[model samples]
Target chain A: MTFATRFRKSIEYQVVEELSRSVRWDANRIVVNTDAERLAGVCEALAKAGGIFDSAVLSSPASTRVPQVCYAFRMPDLGLGVSVFARGKNITCLSTRLDAAAWDERKIKDLAGVQLDGLEDARPLLAHPESGWGDFAEAVSKNRQTVLKPSEAYASREYAMEGTGADGEFEIPVGPVHAGIIEPGHFRFFVGGEDIHRMETRMFYLHRGLERQAVGRHVQRILPLIEQVSGDESVANAVAFAQAVEDLEGIRVPERAESLRLVLLELERIYSHLADLGGMATDVGFYASSSQFLLLREEMMRQNAALSGDRFLRGVVSIGGVDRNATQENLDATADALASFSKAFDELESMTLSSSTFLDRVFTTGKVSAFVADELALVGPVARASGKSCDLRRHFPYGAYKKRAVCESMAASGDVLARFNVKANEVKESARLIRSEINQMPSGPTHTGEKRTGHGFGWGWCEAPRGSCSIFVRTDKGRISRLSIRTASFRNWRGLERAVNGNIIPDFPLINKSFNLSYAGTDL
Target chain B: MHELSALLRAPRTDEISEEATDPAIRKVAALLRRRSGGVFSRSIHVRMVDAGSSNDVEVEEGLMNAPQVDCERFGIHFVASPRHADVLLVSGPVTLNMRRALEKTYAAMAEPRAVVAAGDGACTGGLFKHSYAVYKSGRVDEVVPVSVHVPGNPPSPYDLVAGILQAGLALDKKEAAKSGKS
Candidate 1:
């Protein structure tokens, strides 16, 4: 074994020896049960061992047992996941030491009714004050329907954002409904004239209680709901959830299905990134380039509809493997389409890059320093643009990625231009990956028709178009007892806040587009 | 210059033939064009409110602006504010948190405005209907008067355009009813 693998094994041994009540080792994960008091220490030790904080999930309360909280960390070097679970109503907060755990802890507090002893930001995360429903945690625990009072006068809740108190500072509150065709999110900008002094975003206006809705549902039935987590990220999220269920059942996906999935994923990434690239151009008032990008994106969406019967590419990924295999003719057609697409995309890229006006607007605008990116644990293109190599495809290879290495695309500037370059390059890279995956075209049965009945839990993760999307699922007799999803948007929203600080208000939308974090995914 | 030559070589429009266009979109466009001659002067301003959707509806709405569908060609424009809008295109089974916001947006619109509930979630609360977080059925009609329902997992851009045009007809009827009452 390599040194990093040996070091991680040693840390795992130490954690099991010192903190765990019982240890269960699966293929790519280690689940350790520990006390609530020791939760913070376990997380701290894992962090010291160079583990990246992935997500924190809260399981539903059983009749005789309290809800359990599982904190998952990614040991990228070893390609192993460490999940430390503690069953309790009160758990020690790791947010005091780990800034990345702040949002996860707050979400647990809101949904699970759990109290983290030292969580500083006590404001509600998912449950809004103006929602008019009683305490969400109470409603969830009691399994009671939310009582509606439409007669109650409409009221907007106040979000506290202390201004810089400089001579000309004032706050500009923008959306729960924006001026554009986008999801609803409220942005608070404290500005001194045109330049932004501080920026705070209050999201979760789109929370549909997806996790609570998953309870008592069969594992197979939940894929549709998981796909709803984010529209553009349907395949990635579905694949992640399916992988988790597959892990729980210990079913190996057929090699052909794995290759096909890689194709589908790369296609999704291509179209999704096209939208972002187009949006960035639109924000900068460069319609010439934006139109070309959108045109290509439209063609890509049509191609997706042809491959899978859905425009958004939903219902393709199932528990054991993919739902249907693509015929070689279809694969060849897609490869041909990709050839022309690459040509058009290259011209568009050069056209946008060569434009001095476009460059002037995007270059050095909305910069996220490497330190801020690391502190916030940003993922996907956002982290890669900031010089932090956090691509899950490289670090924790899964599915077809284990066989084929990804050519990493990154930039150190972390500006809007750097993000544009990274995302644009990623689209090209995705097209390349798709073409090669099709060329290799593994021929076999696409699924291992295994029974999914089981009583177990497992972690599933995928590098979504935005970033790494990780899901945690626990099943009882093939029914989902508990489900929690931590999308890349949840990890990277804070990075947007940091990127907007000191930048002008007009550039806010540009920066926001550059990150392109999913409000629905984050809210869910 | 290479840039100048590339710009010249680029096609100005996609120029998709009517036969290649989705029949649903063509039918809606024809209906909208005919209706414009009577009441609307061929223009309808719409403001979209995402009360609570998975955002598939939002993506379709954006696509409606793309060159292929080009809802603007049928005199439909997405305005910045509800005050300027002639219709409120709302997607939901409206979440409780967004209920007030949705209502506020509807109230902000001018008179004779129609609402189009786009997507399965908006019309019938689709998958999230049983969830506690949303209003009854997560249906837009539960919160607002939906003049038309365009239901798909998310209604495609063509269906969305059709629904909006149908909403325009509903708005014209509302206008006629109001003038008669006055």
Candidate 2:
């Protein structure tokens, strides 16, 4: 059977004939707005047809009293997401049917005050109840929805969980204060001796409210903030944001710009993955391999800094094209650096593999079953490590990915070691892609000043170092009215929760570091 | 003792090998011995405040398991309270929510304290320069007297360590000037 036919049959979506009364608008993607009642039926049909819910965002309309909850769905092989907007009098939650919509519903309930009547676990997702949900209420009202009262913010959700368990089942609350030099994230594990019973993760410590702040401001001005969403994945976020804006304006980026974007994106991915490799080594106490990778990462960062003014590759990508262009000298220097760095990276990988201490800790530890990975809808190297072949670059190509085929990396075991292997493999692939992209730079105007109107809906997806970052831009006239960005972190945080189950508390750092999902990305 | 000194001087990548006799490692060994002479005794108590920047949350929690910039290894202790602190670690572009938090933390600190602003967001609001939520258009120095600027998107732990050491050196200079006056 054909992949498409098999996929369609796997998820049973009723192929409905287009009704004459249905209002359809085609711009960036196909859009058909149906009443809230029809939305559930469509979702069921789409689910039956193997269309997965990519992301769902709920925001109360500024002028209307009724809430507007949007569900974004993607059919894997098709590379398309159809957003269904559901509105009603205190609408019923889709989380009941689709397990993925659970968190989305909680976020809606927290910010827009949308009461999802049948939500299974309607815990306050973004706000602290002790501080009062005032900023959340004010956010919905003022259209300034990002910044909430300090007491009721995303960071306040973490604290020591209180409870007693069976004999020898003592609770170990590890962080939101860690021992290493990494981002802040708290984990509470209910442990019996060495084995874990239940583990809960608390991320979002570095929420900058970039989403709330971006509203009302010119979309062009907000690209830099998007780049800073997480310091490491700046290029990916910038490209994703630019692609979204470009799609909305119905403009095609120049060929040279696209090639340069791909090159920079690959370079960015190289440095990011290098750090992850080094971090994984560090976690296993392999200082020799760790330091080697660290020094390599530092060298790459310096090269990147020379190519782009910012060390983190921030503020270089604009809405239409990149802010700066790489000269031939710059491309040549990067090519030369990658050639030598690849040798060093290979040696580091071998040294790490040979190290008994490193392998012992990561091999069978933090095993996330393929079944659980699919259930949680994991992405990036984490899911790839487990034999689930999901790469946004392969599935839905945007930017240079459409032209140049991506070398998708995967490992069968969803353990720390598998994640390490996937990341190591990706480093080589990213370098190969970067060298090719740099070699084939086309000459043309770097940017197109296409007018942005708040008239339609646009969506963009890019494979960030962590995973796939999807952006949905909803425009009012030519300016953005609403934007919902689901970073790689948002989709993959649940996998960490599952990966930690049955593992000892100390092994958490190694497992978490392997994933390296951005706290800022998820929080925002 | 001199033999131990000679051993320290060997150039090494993996570890300080007994038989290795490289010139570069020899030079490093000499440097280490000279520096290690005094037991590296010093501690600087620091009280960190987010200083109203978006960075307030991170500073309040002490930068996720990042080793407390232990100058005491070179000799320094990061104090929890301002009354005992000799240095103030401030992170922010200086936001409206954190303006009062900054002043209160600074006011509570004991005298002869040095302030080190530790991020691009804190050093200069970076991209968040024109927001209404921000109080100052520039660095933390504009609002609070800053002695050191450790700049990065978020500076590495080593950069942070280097900044704190710079602050300690500045403290020594201030102490010398005070003693000279006395």
Candidate 3:
């Protein structure tokens, strides 16, 4: 049976029938006006009936008559999406039932001052100790520039970690300022001798208030800002933001533009995967193969710089379509570069997998069994490596992805080796996809030749190198009213904590590099 | 490994131009590279701090350690601690969350320490300056004094090398000031 039919068969529309709510606007959005108490039951029923939590966004009173919160969910098998709007000064927390809602609810509670009644942890999500969460709530609600005194407000928070209670357990505090060029995040590990008993992550050191800064800006003006959300996934986030805006205005992107965008996304996926693989190799102390991977990455980046002015492929994706069209010469150059990259990449892959030391380190180290991954709703390679078929491209295929089906890579072991295998296989898949898209390249304008000055609420998602970078944009007139971006990294971080529970403290960096979650993406 | 050796010996079509390198900078860099175990300590240990970047700069920084750029050949090596660093390479605008961390890190650096502020964001705060959650200015100079400015959205790998070279000049100036000779 089809998923929608299955969903309908599973549960009657009893929740809505019981509430007697009027369905007001969109085909997917079920508009239910009910008390906070009734709304919780309605959500519980829908979630029980198979609503995968997408993201939760709480808007200021300006967006609604009262302070409002929307819990977004999508059922991939059915290709259906719905938003549950619960309007109140204090909204009910879906996290009571949904494990995935904890992070989103915590963020809402901290940023909007909406008390989540059953929240287990009351610790601030973004604010430092002395900054006072109240000032932040006021500033974000006011949506204006506010001063946070650097001396007092920006103090490093002292995170309290309960003792593991095992007689020999002790903590190893790793960084807000780390070695190398990676972003700042503090990780606390409690270990008894060599084995880690527990771990906690303290981030927001790289939090630059991306959502708060995006308010009241023209859609076109914020493309560059959105591109910086995560540099490697720049094209992916921009495409998601653009698709969300385009869907809002009911605009259609031309065929050629769509094809070009697909190529960009795939190209980005290739480079992003390479960095992770290279990182894994480095962590394993296999510098020779790591250096080779880096060389390959540099070549692809040079090609990106040639096709577009920016190497990360930023500044090219626009709201309507794209900023630049690919010339035949550029396409041919890219194809040739990627062709070489594939050949060399295969050799490097074999070299990496054949190395016994590398295998010994990554084989069963930091394995996240299928059950743990499923419980956390981890996306991207972390989930894929667990042998879970959670590919968004296969399930809710959008844009040019609807035309060409992508075969996602998955491994059953759910270890660092499995992640490596998945990433390497994905690199090959992306390279093949790029070649096919270029050959089937549609001929038309790169952009729709339309400038937008109107707005609506729309959702867009593109499979980033990491995984699904799902975005929701709400606009009024031309300015952005609310933007809720849930990057794969944001959802996947919890999986890291679970994955590292039984691993050694020394292997933490290796396990971390395996997942390679973006600190900035998660913080944003 | 044989294939890797062959690939290394093979000619590269996309050869990065030497013109991007300045003779004076190379002269100093060569001096540093040759002065190993000397009082000059030609090998400069760098510690990098990312304030509020998109991680694009980090990618480029990683590439610098790759076979192509291989920054260690020029006596510039990235160290793990600020205490051991002779130079500090920083990327991104100064975010409020990172302000104290950056300041404390800078303070922890030993004397003769030179800071190279990499990327347009680090140089001038770029697109992130006005955000409420960020330090209003966002520039590296707003928190810690910068010796050289590397400008680009996220400056190219070559631009970063040049900026690091300029930081060599800054180290000398810092030394001169310390000796009451400037």
RMSD of each: 2.2, 7.1, 3.0
lDDT per residue for candidate 2 within A268-357, as digits (tens), equals 889888777878888778766775676677677668878887556666788788778888998899899999989877877877888788
Q: Which ranking of candidates, highest TM-score first? A: 1, 3, 2
TM-score of the second chain in candidate 3: 0.80
Q: Identify the superior model by DockQ, candidate 1 or candidate 2.
A: 1
Off by over 4 Å in 3: A16-35, A59-65, A130-134, A144-146, A150-157, B1-8, B11-41, B180-182
For model 3, what is the error of residue A279's alpha carbon versus the real structure, in angstroms, after optimal superposition?
0.9
In the range A99-128, model 1's lDDT, one tens digit per residue, is 998999999998888889988898888777
Candidate 2 segments exceeding 4 Å error: A1-11, A15-32, A37-41, A59-65, A130-135, A143-165, A452-454, B1-90, B93-115, B123-162, B170-182
- Ordered from best to worst DockQ, the candidate numbers read 1, 3, 2
- Evaluated at residue A327, the lDDT of candidate 1 is 88
Interface RMSD of 3: 1.8
TM-score for every candidate vs. truth?
Answer: 0.96, 0.81, 0.94
* Count of steric clashes across candidates, in order: 1, 28, 0
Root-mean-square deviation of Cα positions for candidate 1 versus the true structure, in angstroms = 2.2
lDDT per residue for candidate 3 within A51-139, as digits (tens), equals: 66677776432344466676766666667676666666566666777787788888888777777776777777887664322377776
